[model samples]
Target: RTYAGLPVLGGDLIVHESASGASRSVDKATDADIEVTDTSAAIAPSGAERSALSAAQAAGDRKTGAEDAPRKVIWAATGKPVLAYETVVTGVRKDGTPSKLHVITDADSGRKLYEFQAVQNGTGTGQHNGKVTVGSVRSGSQWLLKDSARGGHRTYNLKHSWDETKKGSAFYDADNVWGNGKPTIAQTAAVDAHYGAAMTWDYYKKVLGRNGIKGNGKAAYSRVHFGDAYENAFWDDDCFCMTYGDGAGNKKPLTSLDVAGHEMSHGLTSATANLEYSGESGGLNEATSDIFGTAVEFYAKNAKDPGDYLIGEKIDINGDGTPLRYMDKPSKDGLSYDYWKSGVGNDDPHFTSGIANHFFYLLSEGS
Candidate 1:
C-alpha cells in the first residue's frame, strides 16, 4: 500500500489472527515522518520536464524526448519520504546506442534527484569442445533449441541484423543432437552457444547454488549471428538475452564456452553489484566477469578446450593466434597491468581487468 502515492514499507508490521478471523496489527518499523506540507509546487510541470531533459542531456543523451508531464509520487526507497516528479526520457546517442532513462526531480524545487538507464548493455565458443551434450525441448517431431529443464533456455538466430522487431527464428532440428564441431555450418556455432549457456546455468546452479542468472529460476535467451562481419558478443539487459556475432568473413563465430560465460556473468554483475562501468569500479566489473568466465570454463572440463587462465584462447580474435587477454601474467600481452598501482582506474577496463584476473588466478591456482 501507499501513502500520498508513496510506497509504504511493511517491514515493521506484525499481524496476528484469531480463529474467529479477527486480526490485530502492531506497527514498529517506520519512525520517519510521511507528511508533505508543500503540495503547492513552486515549479510548473514544464519546468520539471526541462530539468529532466537537461539532466539527461548532461549525462550524454542525444536526440532526447520526454513526457509532457511528470508524475507526482512519494519516494520512500531512501527511507526519507519526499514528493517528487518522475520523468521518463527515451532517445539514442550519437553513437547509435539507445537509451531509456528515468529521471526523478523534486516536485517543489524542480531539482533533479536521481536517474537510471532502462536498457542493460553490456559470448563465445567452439573450435571449442569436440562434442558436447545440450538440453533441448522436443516438440512434435522437432528438437527445438529450448532447454525445458533450465527454465526453458532458448537460442535464436538473428541472421545478421540488429533490428529487434524482426526477431531471429529459433533453431530446430530433426535430431536431438546439435553442432558439428566446426564453424562451416551455421548450426555449429549455435550448438556451441547453446551448450555454453547450458554449462553456465549448471555452473551457477551446481557450484554457486544460483538457480539462474537472476537467481530467480528464470533462464535468459541467446541470439547468434547478430551482425555482418561482426566479431563480438554482448549481453543486453533490456531483452535479457546474449547476442553473438560472426567473425570476419563470416567464418568464425564468437560463441565459445568461456566467452558465453563471460557475457552471462555481465548480466549477473548488473543484477547484483551493478558496478559502475567506469573508473576503478569498471575494472572490478570486467574482472568479475573474467573470473567467472574462467571458472565456468574449468567447471565444464571439456577436453577440446580444457580449462585455462587465458580468455578467448579458442576464438583467436587476433589474427596472430593469441587469446584476447592473459591472467597468469597479464603483462605478457604487453598492455595489461599484472599488479595494482595508483591510477589504475584510468586504464581501459579490459586492461585493468588483468590485475583482478591475475589475483584470482593466483588465489584459485596459486603460483
Candidate 2:
C-alpha cells in the first residue's frame, strides 16, 4: 500500500494490521506491496533496544519508515518514554555580554531535559575564585563569616522576595556595607531578593514548566548581603534558599540571571536525579544549572537582556572585556578546560567540574 505524507526508506521494517485483527512485521527491503507476518511480540521492541532503534532510525532520517515499526507487544517492551525535548537559551546581556544555557527535559513529565553550569564569573578569594551556587530557591538560611577584627562576628541572612518593577529579583546583601549602602561592609549586593526571586520563579515556570523549586506551584525565598564583602552566591538544600555576597571593590553584583538560575537549578537537581557532586557527576550537576539559567534568560524574553550562550556576561569578573564562561567552547575562559582529559584532578571541585561541563557543551552544542 502506498503511504502518503510518510518518509519511506529502504531496509525499514513496518507492521500492518489485517482485517483479521492480527499484526505482523514486514521488512521493506524485500516485502511485497502487502505482505503479512505474525504476532507483534515476535517483532516487539524492548526498552533498551527501542532506544537504540529510535536513535538509529532518527539518524537514518527515515521519518516515514519508522512510523510502521511495531508497537511493543507490551508497553514496557516498546521503549522508554520519548519525553525529552531540547531547550536552548541564547542571547546577549544588557551590557553586550554573550550568554547561553541549554537544557533537555521530559516533555510529558516536565522533568529536566539536561543541565550544565560552566564557570561564568571568577575572582580571587583566598583559595577559591568567585563562586556561583546552583540549588533550590529555598528559604530561611543564614551565613556568618569570621570577622576577628570586628570583635563581634559578622552575621548574614538569606531571604527571597518579589518585586514587579525591576523586571527581575535577587538574593541581595541585606546588611552588608555594600548591600543597601549602609557603608559597613564596603561593598553591597547590587541586586537583592527582587532579582534572585525573579530569576528563580521565571526560569522554572517559563522553561521547564515547573511550578517552583518543589514543583508544588509556590514562591521561593531568598537573601542578599550575607557577609562583609561576601564574594559569592550559593544555594543550600539544608537552608532551602540562596545567599549572595557584596561585590568586590565596588565591581558587580552576584545576582545575574545565570547566577540566580544556576542556584535555582541546583535545587531542582537535588529534588530530582540528585547527581553526585565532586567528580564527573559533580561537574554534570553544575552544568545542569548553568544550562537552565541560560535558558531562563531566553524564556524571560526581556528585550533588555536577550539570552546568549555566555554566562555571567554582565558582571565583569575578569575586567578584560570577556564573558565569565562560554558554553559553545568553555575553554574560552583563560582558566576553564575545553574538554576532559588526564590530570583533570579531583582536587578542586570546580576544576574537576569540567567533565560534565564538557559533556553539556557537547550535548547542547553538539561535538
Candidate 3:
C-alpha cells in the first residue's frame, strides 16, 4: 500500500503466504502496480539512481502445518548508488485485528538479525496489513520488530562514538530553563553536549574518515550557559572544547545543529587548510564550517528539520529575522557580500566571507 509520495517500506504480499512460509522477496515493483505518487520531489545528484524494494519470503518449516517464518530484505543504498530515503508506511487494520510486520536485516547475506514483528493499525479503505518504510540501514546492524499497532511507537537514538578513544562528555540540566526563566524540558548543558558529541563523531567518520576531532582519536568537551545572557557560541583551540550562550532576546539556546557543526568544523579547518583567520583564507575558513554544517544536516534528514541551503535560520542571528548567511546569493543578507574582490580584508569576517561561501554552495548544489 502507498501513503503520500513515499513508498511504504514494506508491502502486503506477506499476508497471502503462510505466516511461517519461506521468505520470498521482490526488489522491483512496477510503478503502475504500487501507484507511487512522489510528493517530496527531491532531486538526486547527477547519474544517481534509486534502488527498488523487493518482496521477500520467510524461511521455516512449511510442511506438517508448521508456520513458515517471514522473509527478510535489506533496504540497501550506497554512496556510489545514491538514492533518496524511502518513506516507510505504518498503521493498523480495519477490524482492530493486528497484522504481523517483521523487519529482517542482512537478508541478502545468510547472517540475518533476529526477526521482530510489527502490528498493523488502520481500518476501512485505509486499512493496511503491514508497515513499510523507505530507508536503508548499515549492514551488520539490522533489527526486526513487531508491527507498531501491536503496541506503542518505537523510538530510537543512534548514539555511537565515531572516535571511541575520545574522552569527556557534556551533560545537560534537564530541569533548568534560561531567559524565559521557566523550566526547560531539558537543561541547556545536556542539549549542547549531546549535539556537539554527535557532530564531532559523525563529521570525522563520514567526511574525513578520521577517528575524532583530533585525528589522533581524542574526545572534546562542550559547555553551555557559561554565564548570564551569553549571545554566541565559540570553540577555543586552547580549551579544545566549545561553549554556547543563550540568545539575548528570547531564551533560545545557542547550541543549535548548525552552530555546533560550525564550531566543530573549525577544528577540522585548523587541522587542514589552517586558513589564516584574517584574509580571503579566513573567509574560506568560515565557509568550511558552513559547508560541512549544511552537509551534516542533509545527512541527518530529520523529518522536522531536513537539509536546505539556508544557514543558521534556526538561531535567528538577524535582529529583525533572517538567516545569518545565504549561499545562493550571499549579499541577500545585506550584511554580507556576494562576490569576491581584492583588498576585502577579513576585518568583517561576515562581509569578506561571501566568495568562498557562495563557491561551496555551487559545488554542493550545482549552478
Cα lDDT tens digits for candidate 3, 1-367: 4344233343333323446885555443222243322333243211011111111123221111102332222222211111133212222234323233343333222232333323322110100101112111112233221112211211111122232233323221122221121214223333333433454455566566876666665655555554455567777777676666556642555655667777878877887778888777777788888888777767655443457777777666665667788888988977777776767764577666777778878887788
Candidate 1 structure, TM-score to reference: 0.65
* lDDT of each residue in 34-116, candidate 2, tens digit only: 21132122222333234433333333322212223222211111123232333333333343222333333333344332332
Each candidate structure's TM-score, on Cα atoms with residue i matched to residue i, is 0.65, 0.46, 0.50
State the lDDT of candidate 1 residue by residue for 34-126, as single tens digits: 666755667777888898889889888888988456777665445666777778887765554456688888887787878876542212234
Q: How accurate is candidate 3 locally (lDDT)?
A: 0.47
Cα deviation in Å at residue 229, candidate 3?
1.8
Q: Which regions of candidate 3 deviate over 4 angstroms?
A: 1-189
Q: For model 1, state the Cα shift of residue 365 in Å.
A: 2.2
* Order of models, best TM-score first: 1, 3, 2
Q: How does residue 29 of candidate 3 score in lDDT?
A: 27
Clashes of 3: 53
On lDDT, who's better, 1 or 2? 1
Q: Determine which window of 10 residues in candidate 2 has minimal summed lDDT.
A: 122-131
